[model samples]
Target: MSVTKDVAALAQPVIEGLNMDLIDTEYIKEGSKWVLRLYIDKDGGVGLDDCQLVSEALNDLLDGADIIKTPYTFEVSSPGLDRPLKTDKDFQRYKGDMVEVHLYAPINGSKLYTGTLHDRKDGMITIVCEEKEITFAEKDIAKINRAIIWN
Candidate 1:
């Protein structure tokens, strides 16, 4: 099995046991070191205690299984506030909120757009900036970060 799959199989139980969702996992070889990154989340948010719980459990599992077969670093973290806006559900939830997006292909004259997400329907995103509404195709979006609004 692939390292990612193997890690998921082992990590899922640890996450589920704590009543958390395993958002994502990545096993990467950077230079001579292998890095295992685990992204976890819960209903409202994630805290240090949650991370520690998962980390401790995952460490025990890794040590016991010896599956990695090499020295590596394990990192468990939350996706954070400015998490990537990937899915349609993400866009829908944050509609009317301000966001910053980077697109692979330049739209009009720029690749980065920061404005209010006027609406999102189907696979189209309409952003209202200044006085104009700019439309974007979902596939063209490279990365999107939610903009924090403070009253």
Candidate 2:
């Protein structure tokens, strides 16, 4: 398995024990440093204490496992306001919220769409855009994120 997946596997129990959802994990090299970022969340929101708690526990787990040979910075935090909708639970949780959808290919001459997330069922996602509901197969989506509305 990939380092990201390995680290995520190690971190999952620790995060869940504290009642937080492991939203995503990324292991990447930036400049001269390798970084392991863990996005976590729970009802209402996540706080610094929660991040620190997960970080400490996960650090111990990683150190004991020694799965990563290279030195890396570890970070645990919330998935912020414009987080990506990665799971069915996430789609359901954010139902009625505005979202920006990017498709793998253009749908009706457009590759991008912004609308209120209507529903996800039968392997399809429905979004209400411009007073009309547009349904797209989930496989056709490249990315779906909560829209960051200003004002």
Candidate 3:
């Protein structure tokens, strides 16, 4: 297994046992700190205690494991209200909902698209913005999240 995969594999069991799903994981460096951001979730929602429990358990495991050699900060938290959608399945689940998408490349002279998520099937998303139907490649989305519109 790849080193990153190996680390994630070792960490998955512990996360699952705590009744949390790993929404996302990032092993990155921020200036002097290597931050391990573990975005976790549950069925209804995630709370403070959920994050605390996972943080404590993961810390204990990390302390015992020799997987990471650099000084890093471990952050365990909910994906939040505006959770970033990273997969076609994510778009599928939130289909019929509104969303904001940022693309790696401009589509029809626009890199940002915001509209009602009208479609999510066969690995593509159709967002209706201002009576115009804009299609985006599932892979080209750099960042996508459920849009919070208070209306």
Top lDDT hit:
2
Ranking by lDDT: 2, 1, 3
Looking at model 3, the pairs that clash are none
Model 2, 24-62: lDDT tens digits are 998989999999899998877789998998898888789
Task: Compare the candidates by TM-score and give the number of the best one.
Answer: 2
Candidate 2: C-alpha RMSD after superposition:
1.4
Tell me the TM-score of each prediction against the true structure.
Answer: 0.71, 0.92, 0.75
Winner of 1 and 3 under TM-score:
3
> How many clashes in each candidate?
0, 0, 0
Task: Report the lDDT of model 1 for residue 50.
Answer: 91
Could you give me the TM-score of model 3 versus the true structure? 0.75
After superposition, the stretches of candidate 3 with alpha carbons farther than 4 Å from their true spots are: 1-4, 130-133
lDDT of all predictions: 0.83, 0.91, 0.80
Model 1 earns a TM-score of 0.71
Comparison by TM-score, 1 against 2, better one: 2
The residue pairs that clash in candidate 2, if any, are: none
Q: Which stretches of candidate 1 lie over 4 Å from their true place?
A: 29-32, 87-96, 117-121, 126-128, 131-133, 148-151
